[model samples]
Target: MPNARISLPKAKLSAVLGHLAKIPASLSMTTIQTSPDGLWLYQSGHGLDVQLCFPEARTESRVTTSVNTAALAQMVSVAPGEAVEVEVGPSGLKFGTGGYRASLNGLIVDYDEPPIEAEGGVVVPIAELGRAIRCVRHAVGGVNRPHFRGVQLEFSPGNLRAVASDGYRLARYDLGVDGPLNGKAMLPLKPLDAALGILSTQDGAATLQLHGGRLAVIGEAVRLALTPMGQGLPNVENAIPKSYVAEAIVDPRALIQAIRRVSLLSPQDNRRIDLSFSEQRLEVRGAGDYGEGRDEVPLDTYRGEPLALSLNAVYLYDALSCIEGMARIKISDPRSPIAVEALEDARYLGVIAPILNP
Candidate 1:
């Protein structure tokens, strides 16, 4: 029942508070739970729970009160390099540095401990996990369909896979790890996005705990938990053809630039772009009311017969942007799904369904 005071570097406090500010506004509780060790702020709603703990803060006594996440972040953001002193009293929480001080009233709410279980999870490099998330996040669909709004994570003894799809396109990223893991889970897009933001501020490693119907990501100063989608993800492996009749190898950067140039002429409503590839050149064409545009990019290698396919410009661009060095566009036919693989890294793959009518 005594006032609790804590002190931390302004930049550190600001960084942690920035993550807390990302929590959905729909979540009710906005309280800060403090103990002798550090301060905690948590919020849960829409099947996702996020908590940020400042374990490095120097604390005295104990307190439980809620403060405005935005206000706290703003206060610290302006404080810059100074050390911030946070004192929790009956009236509210006070934030101060060398010359500036401000107070905000705290909200009273019953705080329940967040269900975060980090046991039996694999320790993965933060950079690797972040890369995997970015590779597939764009493919995740909107909230209208709950099942397609998440990324599927498949784990084996030495392999970890992340897959996401929006019915039209799918992304799969495989990572090798030395750990004991054998299961599959779906991680909602919102929490996954939030986890990525938190992970960006951290270095070294992060623990991924998946058990029951929940997935918890434990980072340096942040912890995120979310309920996995109940419905099963589509069998993505089957969607990718075992072999291709034609393969066109092109520089990823050139392909990306060509797509962007042609897409400028594509209509806003029907943004379809045609990719015609033969032995020497890969031509990208787009037509609309605004007229048409075309760009021919030289290919490194082209195998099999000529192939022409129409696809959503955005979808193709998204797939191409994720690839690093060279990209191979493998096609069985114009009607069948087209496969995109990164030449530098075989672990990342993308599939986009062609616009059959176009």
Candidate 2:
């Protein structure tokens, strides 16, 4: 029996497991392997594959094994000590530190060597990528809405853009950073969300690589291999109305506060909010079986025709959440969807479809 052993500081090991926590529970097997470069932990789920590497723990020989994910995570998180020890067993893996040791049962699965890097992959700016994903993820569709359940990444040199939609609402974030990727790729929502979280805890840049024709984001210790989701999210640029007859600028924070204040009396089922925009002012009204509530916010730079539009209050709240400073709303007509953008930053854009007021 070739037992593989690895040792690392407690915090490092805990950090690795913490990132793994973001992965969906379905892929419940952990694959441990040793390479000339270092020690690797791999798991796959939600049409995505995640791999973490510890380059400092290079061993002399090659060893690979798969164990139950939950068991491993539990043993590591609850185990005591400042140094972590791992050893492979015939059908399981052992974890120990100082005076504590535990053995976890393994799973009957095979993990062939997966490519961690390609010949020519791009290094993605972690801060930019994380922020971009956050800006657009809210608009991503739910499980039932499979067609729009992923994000489209328009990656090219000197520019990176991410767009997501759920048919009713669309969000886009354009980053003015440079990368070597030149084409577009669609990534499943869960994996992207996990990757975003994992990256938040990490520092430095991550790589955008193609492993067996699948796109992946490889961080210093974390690798998110995204299995592209469905196709044809609504065109973000085309979806934004080219011109609007009415526009209004309002402080997003204040508007959100006003919406929430009036929403206290709104009906739970629909929580409908009626928005009436006109010269230098905007009126927000929320109504339900409890009765109706109205709040007015003075608009800045209001122009063009007066517009009365009905929208779902919850959806409107989400639309405003991403906007920092002031929001400039491009209101075309009562029936047309409104375009919202940040006045201080042009990188983000959002569109919300109106619902029937009555």
Candidate 3:
């Protein structure tokens, strides 16, 4: 028998959706099995029987059918109780749910065009897309803020770039793609993420078109369109001065592991990691109710004057892990912001602001 999936109406819809978020977004192949009891979605990688947990409600409905993971992701914005019309096709499947729909003429858009273009078009690897998208998604504001907590995507034909900062932690990743778009724009994390949820399941390189502030992703069997937030993102190049140049070399994972261990002792709300430079050594310190713990990491070589600066451990950890290489890191000053460059290569660059109180 062919496998199928059913969408059951829920009493507590938010809870149901939250649970779904934990499931891998790329598991697009699912079977909706309906039996005497109710409905069950059978898919690889998920263990144990799945049950719908719902509170009291007036009415609920479940639709049992097979759906591509990308098709299910398109319904992310649709509210419960809303009707989702589904139909199958030979080339690609079509469905209307949540924030997306199929046109009356039967035109299905899995991909939208980009606002601008590069020479040959930008081709990004699936794993790179997943890592960069995941890091920045957490920094995007759940609720809209005036100009902060948004994601800035920049392409220069030579590099595909993404950055997200919420005035607390800033995350950025730059990787080589087919085309690094010279143009840039800001898009809310939610929609870009929805697009990635569709991409994560596919293999090979993905093509992107950035035009009119809209991004379209062309994949093997799926296409994704994401409307940019449209507010002009700050000129990231000028957000911090280019002259705050000081250099220190360290391992990406070493710093990450050290901070992760120390952060366990730091308060979540007021987490602080202090860095002090002594000769060629870097000292990391953090304090909490359990007192303070300190760890020293050796630096490859230090340039300029020694300094002590305190930063949010969580933010530094987040930034360091994003970059690849056990190499040098450049800093302007303890008071000024920090910029990270990959020593092994120049695939991407990262910048972060210093915490005032940390």
Candidate 4:
């Protein structure tokens, strides 16, 4: 009967749409639902589902429609700092920004409210929390295993832990929180990646709510709802060794550089890097069909029996990149899992399964 219209600042709308752009095209969830109150976008595929919402003041006209998500995101990205005016009428939806204006065809879909469990969710500081997630996300496994494709978040009194493993390497990060929290959830990678990207652009704190098989991340400019993995994560905590026969404390940056040089000779497939520790130094060696490389760095402290282990060079780099200052490597034997610790921050830990035949 009447045209419905709403206005939004270009920067805010672009940020929200940028998150939606991360969602791949899907037959069921590619459309963005718009209403008098705000905008909505949902994407579901494989075993993961994600929903993003941007709420604003309600307009008098109760118009509702769905538009292509990519189209809207592209339009807003090119017009930064300008105001956007959206009008929905019988013909289609009109998008106007600055001197540019265009019309997009719309579809009508049944809009069901997303189930959000905000009760008793822990509040986490955005800056540190976002950094922690980014550091560990690289270790998450591929889509073949749904359970390993997500990050395990454990919330306890005064602390929040993030853990991820790809069977070969595991990453753990710990952050302090105010008050108490008691819950654990496996968050899918897609939504977690989007949430991290959104949080990077904003300030202040974000709330994490996990209930009823859903995880909701409420931020300043956006809200995200994600489906938790149905299966349980592997018992990684038990795999960490309680005692070590060999320990070496060395500078993380120096070790990282040495590993990078040796990795140049690593095979493309396995990318093996051999680590040898003695009383005086730590030697990193890599050999492949093409060539061989080796580099040794002095260790601040070394004790116990001599130990050597072979592992994926990239995995070691990924684990070390997250740490600062001195890093301690504890080993029971060449066959057992090696524990990597940041001496400065006891809250951070990494484990890499050694290569058996190497």
Candidate 5:
């Protein structure tokens, strides 16, 4: 008996077919039946399946890949379609007239090279995108917090932003896009990291599409898609205090190196590093089991009050590291969080939570 199959639009159906062709033999592929609103990729003991659903016939195409067979079985089964025409090539896998059809672990996988969508969306320079992704990904929360462990991307006309924070520290970067796009999504750390690596190897611009919880980056010859993380990112921008007076400008690497040397002696309880700025001297010192080590860096100018205060050694280092140039750090008081700002090439701001001393 011929397997029963449903009809999917040419554009979407082609995408699903192409994805299967790209799967490596390390993974298996099998034919799937189309369900009422989606298609399922199924396997046997491996019990893995890729379920792709079309919520609205007009919605952007979506592809879901999974290795969980138990979860795949629960998904509704549908009639199978005849082997559609597909093709394989050396540059990369392609599908259409001729392609391989197989099942891996229980899920149908494709190596289809779907036709690239129309251009004229949001485009970001590969270098800028690569830098922003790498810088922010470092600050993402660890895997322990599945929800907050990704970089948040926000896009608007002429602006693109990426931010990451692991509660202890935060980092952000901004880029100027070629056109307009109003959308936001969270890209998982691992995939975002991979994308950065991919962008670094390529040149020119990459068009990014953030529709239907899907992120697609189209470079010169490569097209990549990732499912957006459906979790809330903390509002870090609003956390900055409105008023802060004490400001210190110094070298970022110098500040980081000083913290690293001093941290060796500072007690964990008193992760405190005291800052003394008066006349033409600026000093950062930490006290602990190893006694104390201080680095006094000369200042070009000092406008704030001569002040001494304690701060978390890590937070200060984190904010300083994010700044690309010499940093101007502001201190409000003995108990207020520190504000770190750099040259205004881009409107970037970061505030560290203060450690209150009893």
Candidate 6:
């Protein structure tokens, strides 16, 4: 005899698993809880934590059962039809639909934990959230520095700004909106991704709840929260130069294309491309063991002194890719970092360190 049985829509269950899977697999058991509210799948380990709730899942009574996460994920992925029926019994757990039965062993035990307190969070617009996460994702740190691996978010009553740096390059996005939170917080990619991924399934999902050193994305049907990576957070603002002279305004598409075409003849080892700006035209030069190449692009405007600087072609290309229509290339000197700004959208910014060549 089973203690309880519940039928969950296949689509809903699979969606919940998709979010839970983002949590790094750990020996810490993945458990599901049943109560009057709904079914909650909980998993946490290695500085990442996530909780997903299915408010629609029916339950006969209250119970928390440790489950084989891999088995459950596989079953949900291949399970057929609109709904799948699951039962908890003394011998094991059973799954099937329409009279078919697939019995899988389960660990039945008493588990107790308080629900994620999802209250008193500020409403962050979905557009701002997307912009902040996407721009920073491309520029986060490598394994060289653990602190560089996360992005810092500063919230004020007027706007929200997010910045990320990978030592070589940095990116930031600013959006104007009314936000309740104040002060700056450093959040690792794990929790941000989990929040964004789970939010995609929900309609009209807004607000991020920060409680107990964890950040959560709350939605109508499902909610997820993960721990923030707060230690040794990099000081990014000081590294970004405050003053830059706009040297040239150019179309990003043409510039990116010119770099690709000119780098073909350059060596594969460095991929270092030199930029020489004068008058209304800019020259891109690349040299490698194979040979050398140069291409010229027309600039909309030019200012400051005649400028010549070198940088990795890949880095500049990525920085330019994020800009909108017209991009201003600003530089203070050959020894300083370069700034790429989107004239159309002042909210986005990118900085790349110049490669000093003798």
Of the candidates shown, which would achieve the greatest TM-score relative to the real structure? 1
Error of 3 at 242 (Å): 1.6
Candidate 3 residue lDDT tens string, 1-358 = 2322234443223333333444444553444324444443333322211222112211223334445543344353353345444333323334445555552212222322222232255777777777776756555544656465467777885777777766544556676664645776676654455445545545677677775456656555344445566475555556554775568888878778788877777766768778887667888888888878888888888887888887777667756765666655667877777876678866545566676652
- Give lDDT for model 4: 0.76
Roughly what TM-score does model 5 have, to 2 decimal places? 0.66
Enumerate residue pairs that collide in model 4. Answer: none
lDDT of 5 by residue, 142-179 (tens): 77878788888888777888887777666777776646
What's the true lDDT of residue 35 in model 2? 69
Q: Tens digit of lDDT per residue, candidate 4, span 31-98?
A: 45555556555555444454555566345565555666677687667753467787765445787766
Off by over 4 Å in 1: 25-28, 80-82, 108-115
Give the lDDT of residue 66 in candidate 6: 77
* Best-first order by TM-score: 1, 2, 4, 6, 5, 3
Name the runs in model 5 displaced over 4 angstroms: 1-111, 115-119, 268-272
lDDT of each: 0.80, 0.79, 0.57, 0.76, 0.59, 0.75
Q: Cα lDDT of model 2 overall?
A: 0.79
RMSD of each: 2.3, 2.9, 12.3, 3.3, 11.3, 3.3
Pick by lDDT: 3 or 4, better one: 4
The model with the greatest lDDT is 1
Q: Give the TM-score of candidate 3.
A: 0.62
lDDT of 1 by residue, 279-326 (tens): 999999999998999999999999999889899999888998888888
Candidate 2: misplaced stretches above 4 Å?
1-5, 9-12, 18-27, 81-83, 88-91, 107-112, 119-121, 209-213
Ranking by lDDT: 1, 2, 4, 6, 5, 3
TM-score to true structure, per model: 0.91, 0.87, 0.62, 0.84, 0.66, 0.83
Decide which is better by lDDT, 1 or 5.
1
Residue 220: error of model 5 in Å? 0.8
